[model samples]
Target chain A: MITFDDVVKVYPGGSTAVDHLSLELPTGKTTVFVGPSGCGKTTSLRMINRMINPTSGRILIDGQDVAGQDDALLRRKIGYVIQHAGLFPHRTVLDNVATVPMLLGKSRKEARTAALGLLERVGLSAEFASRYPAQLSGGQQQRVGVARALAADPPVMLMDEPFSAVDPVVREGLHREFLRLQKDLGKTIAMVTHDIDEAIKLGDVVVILRQGGKLAQIGTPQELLDHPADEFVAEFVGRDRGLRSLSFDTAAGLPVRPLTADLLLDEAGRPVSWGDGEPTGGTFTVEDSLRLVTDLAITSPVGIAVRVDANGKADGLVPHHDLVDHLAERRAAK
Target chain B: MNLSYLFDAAHWSLTADGSIPQLILSHVWYVVLALIIGTIIALPVGLYIGHTGRGSFLAINAGNAGRSLPTLGLLMLMVTLLGLGLTPVLIALTVLVIPPILTSAYAGMRTLDHRVVDAARGMGMRPWQVLFKVELPMALPVMMSGFRSAALQVVATATVAAAVGLNGLGRLLIDGLAVNDYSRVLAGAIVVAVLAVVLDLILALAQRWIVSPGLR
Candidate 1:
């Protein structure tokens, strides 16, 4: 866990980059710092690794004060990833990932072996190991950056807009991979990004800051979307937050009807068509989010969403009206 | 123009003091000595200024000042003060070598992607480690170009040593001119030009070997 205890950062010229801010980033989870420009999200992230020293108060990592630690030592324990990967242009992808391990006193062979595994863990093939950073695409480079940060197996990772450099399609793919990796590693992570949707997608906890580095709200993605603390937060999370919040709830609890004869099934029990027409909309599963189910139901020509089982066999259906009723019940409970 | 002097086996005798082989050795000795002294004096200062961003004014102005000071004039002044031998010639050649090296080193550091440096520091590299491991390697291409130019200048300029009673390839030119033997002067000119090209080619090969293939 990382704790910010009334931390403040006043630049030499008297600009308050971070006002008196206090927060706890829970261990083994991702906390995202998000804000408009000059809100100090990046500054706050840097403070955890002592990249930017706080003018007053203390930042503690796992109960130890970072201010008292040596800059290099503290940084070594905290992995850092930034936009553009900031890779060493001269080093091959494998050696770049092996940097921290070698710094930590691992032999070259040991570090390289560890790095090769890490590259695979980050979804890169072995062929990429010998290649220079310049040879890879922006998305590939970012993956290598993540691999390098994880090479030393540090408990804490700090990311500064790590995905912002890639295109949206690539960013989506990276986001999924990042979440999968985080699930397995369970490292304490603090990431800074200006994009709220990205924060909502990746963060287990979201911290929103106003223009003057003041805290606007701090909560889970659903909490911020469903119950914004103020008008500013409500506007910041956007008008479609209610619809967005449904992503947190799964379609499992919604009432489903028995698949009737009108809905044709394949030999494997997968939904094939509705009456004489093909299933116009895609199918969802019980594990899928309510938002996806809702979308499928609304888009289906027959006004029903087919819910598939684990084996991709159609077993249930949720009519559009039933989804509306379920949504109403959820809102009333909230 | 003077093929006879170069082709003459008698003039090529290694044992003879003023023969082509001996003159070439003396010329090479002067160039090597000047380069060693210049690099020792300039490389560290250049790296320091480039790394810290301090003394930038000194770095920027030193190049122009060093260039403007005529090598012949400086050598003559040094000879007047110190009264000759190899010292005055070395002093002038070393001065000629400093500016390019210092300026290019500074420019190399300044032009580096700041983000790479930030990443290095963030990864827990000590200041010295960052300099030697990251900054120095990246800056090599620029620094080598500077060193090559310095070498070329020194090789060409070391000929002036012959004007000060020193033994070098320049002896052929000065001695040839005195006796009106155009063949020896032409032989000296051809040898110096060839030596400069050969030295540059060697340095270029060294640069290719040392610099990372990734950069290319």
Candidate 2:
């Protein structure tokens, strides 16, 4: 667990960058610090690694004061990722990932072997091992950044807008892959971002800060979305938070209607285009979030979402009207 | 305007004093020593100022002072003070070599992507490690160009050493002029220009070989 005990960062010019802020970030969970520009979210994230020192107050990891440890030794025990990857342009992809391991005194060959495995884990192929960072696309370079951070397998990871530099489509893919990796690894993580949607999607605890480094609010993504502490948070989370909250709800318990003759199918029992030759609406599995289910229902020409089994065959359908009723009941219950 | 002295076998002979081969070797030697000494002095100072962001004014002013100093005047002054010898010539030439190297090293380190440096620091690299492993490697292309410019300046200016009775390529120009050996003067001018071009080309090749292809 990481604890910030009334930490305050004031620059030499007498301007406070981070106010007397206090918070606790739990272990094995992802906590995101999010705010507008100059809100001290990045400042707070950087303080964990001592990149930005707090003018006063203490930052502790597992009840030990971080200020007491040697700076380099303290940093080596944590993983850090930043926007644009911040990779060494002179090093090959393999060597870049191997850096921290080598710094910790691992032999070159051993570090490289471990780095290759990390490359694959972060969705890179063996072919990318020898290429320089410039040779890879922006998304590919970000993946390498992640691989490099995970090289030492530190118990904690600090990310400063790690995927913000990539395009939205690539960012989504990275988000999915990142969550999958986190699920498997369960490392204590602290991330900073300005994107509310990203914070909701990835953070177990979302910390919203306002200008002057003051805390605006702190809660789960659902709590923040369901009931923002004030107008500022509501505005910050964006105007569509009600619709976005549906993302956390699973569609598994929703009612599904039996498939009708109007539903078109192919020889393999999969949904196909209607006779008009246009493609049928997108499919939603039982495990998909309600947001996707609602999208599938709204877009279907026949007013029903095709529910596909594991084999991609149509199992059932969710009528558009039924989704509306379920969402209404869910909101009323809250 | 006569150029026959360049092709004349007597000028080319190693045994003759002020021969093309002898003059060329002496000229190259002066350039090499000045560059080595200048770099040894300037490189570390530039890097230290750049890395710490301290004494930047010193780096900037040093470069401007180097560019403005009159090389021939400095050589004559040094010769008067230190007496006619290699010391006066070398001292003058070495001054010309300092600015480019110092300024380039400082500029190269200053302009690197700070994000990369931050990442290096955040990843637990000691300050010295960051300087050597990250900053120096990235700054090499710019620093090398600085070195090249310094070398070229040293090569062209070493000829001024002949004013103080030093034996170098400049001797051809000084002696030829005294005896009205216009052909020898032309030959000296031609050889010096060619040497400058060849040295610059070698430096360019060295830069290409030393710099990581990833940077390109």
Worst 10 residues of 1 chain A by lDDT: A276-285
The true-versus-predicted C-alpha distance at residue A125 of model 1, in Å, is: 1.8
Q: Over the stretch A209-249, how does candidate 1's per-residue lDDT look in tens digits?
A: 99878999999999999999999899999999999999999
Error of 1 at A75 (Å): 1.5
Q: Clash pairs of candidate 1?
A: none
DockQ of each: 0.77, 0.81
Error of 1 at A101 (Å): 1.4
Instruction: Report the C-alpha lDDT of model 2 over B18-96, residue by residue, as the tens digit.
Output: 7899999999999999999999999999999988899999999999999999999999898889888899888899899
Candidate 2 Cα misplacement greater than 4 A, ranges: A257-280, A306-308, A311-317
Query: What is the TM-score of each predicted model, taking all chains together?
Result: 0.97, 0.94
Q: Cα lDDT for residue A46, model 1? A: 87
